[model samples]
Target: MRACTFVRASKEVVDVADVAALVKADLERARDTNVTFSRHAMRVVPVETTCFAGVDEIKEACKPLIEKHFKSGREQTFAIAFERRSNNTLHRTEVIEAIAGMIEQPPNKVNLGDPDLTIMVEIVKGVACLSVVQDYEKLCKYNLRMVAMTKEDREHAKATANGNAPAPGTKKNDEEKPAEAAD
Candidate 1:
């Protein structure tokens, strides 16, 4: 299976060769082989190295491309999403609502999330992945993973369990203390 790198790029003026070169450079930096770029995405195979440090890096790297390719001299917004399950069924409306809820935006505004934008992603096997979604309704056809709790929430839970106190370095055992002399 070919591994693809999806980039949310600007719809501004761009050169396909430049994009391809950039993708090639990125893959080489990551020590990967078999890299290719499509009109909206990039794909690579035999990914042996790490070219992208994180999602932010990927986004940053593609910002210029997006601006170069999708810029229409109009204010626009967009989202990035990916397809997860290869066999899950999705309802258009449900997907839209889910995205809206996730982004804390109104459902109607999803389509307007980004205009003149295209979804970018790579699919392994039968999987379809688009990181940014302008239309949530389009996402209901895939099986997505459950949203995990934020780091803040986990920390808050631990602190609450510890009586709002910082975590102690070690556990104190009352059992080790002389049994209270049967008081």
Candidate 2:
């Protein structure tokens, strides 16, 4: 079976039926309410092949779907992501590059940091399920508990490093401006 795992602080193996029931109960508990049964994941398996033949096949399979995402409806910068579930001949980097090339608009903008649309590919078993998900935030999100740090901050974090570096959580460190842009 094809599955997509999610990370929760609790790290629970969610049961789909239980989730549905809970949502329904919560919604109905509000008096007048409508509960919509949402489908979250799609599973597909190829009959002939156990895995994609090559990156070319992946690119071709993605082309038609890419059009719907880029060729119609609205125009926006995009990014490609791949989730490989099984051992496959295609290398991840090559897969992205190849598919990006096959996408109709070659010179189209690619926004790694903030893409308006994300072409997400999930290859499970051998079946390839391609989707153009506009809700990219759900796919990639930052953890609230973690703070993004710079190179200097990262270096100082190493246990082997020792220096006059201002220790973390010190009032003096908090007042200091981030070190000048890395040369």
Candidate 3:
């Protein structure tokens, strides 16, 4: 589908956010150059690996991801965000709980409100696309338009691409901008 396409990059691309950032930059550049079709993308979801939609397959796929992101014994909060389309064989709770059970706790905790890392599980048909991503919630869950809509979101997205933090007070929505007085 044009709206969503699965992209598999070489090992140099670390996470979904990285692909999203690359797409965002390319889109931004296209838009700046007045490329009309640059506005076509609405969301950009990235995945590190794919597996058949089964508990065992998912567990096997998640091993390396869990090791890379959580095995260092760092205190990081995470959440499992699940999305399914044209697939209902796997229960959401079951999949989430299964993945959650695999990660070691105490050093790592689950924070639904705001997680430092997000394990994105997208089940399209019978295939499962998985990725451990940072700033999932912050980037509007990888929505291209939302991330590129405002100057602030753009700045934050850019910082995220460069592995930096957004400047303080840049998270405000467009509606929250100060109104201009009538001339």
lDDT for each candidate structure: 0.36, 0.50, 0.77
Which candidate model has the greater TM-score, 1 or 2?
Answer: 2
lDDT of 1 by residue, 63-84 (tens): 4434453445554445444433
- The sequence of per-residue lDDT tens digits that candidate 2 reaches over residues 81-171 is 6776775654678878887786556446777777766666666666555555542442222111111223354346543255656656665
What would the TM-scores of all predictions be?
Answer: 0.26, 0.47, 0.68
* Backbone clash numbers for all candidates listed: 27, 0, 0
**Could you say which candidate leads in lDDT?**
3
Q: Which is better, 1 or 3, measured by lDDT?
A: 3
Worst 10 residues of 3 by lDDT: 29-38
Off by over 4 Å in 2: 1-53, 73-75, 104-107, 138-183
Candidates, ranked, lDDT:
3, 2, 1
Cα error, candidate 1, residue 90 (Å): 22
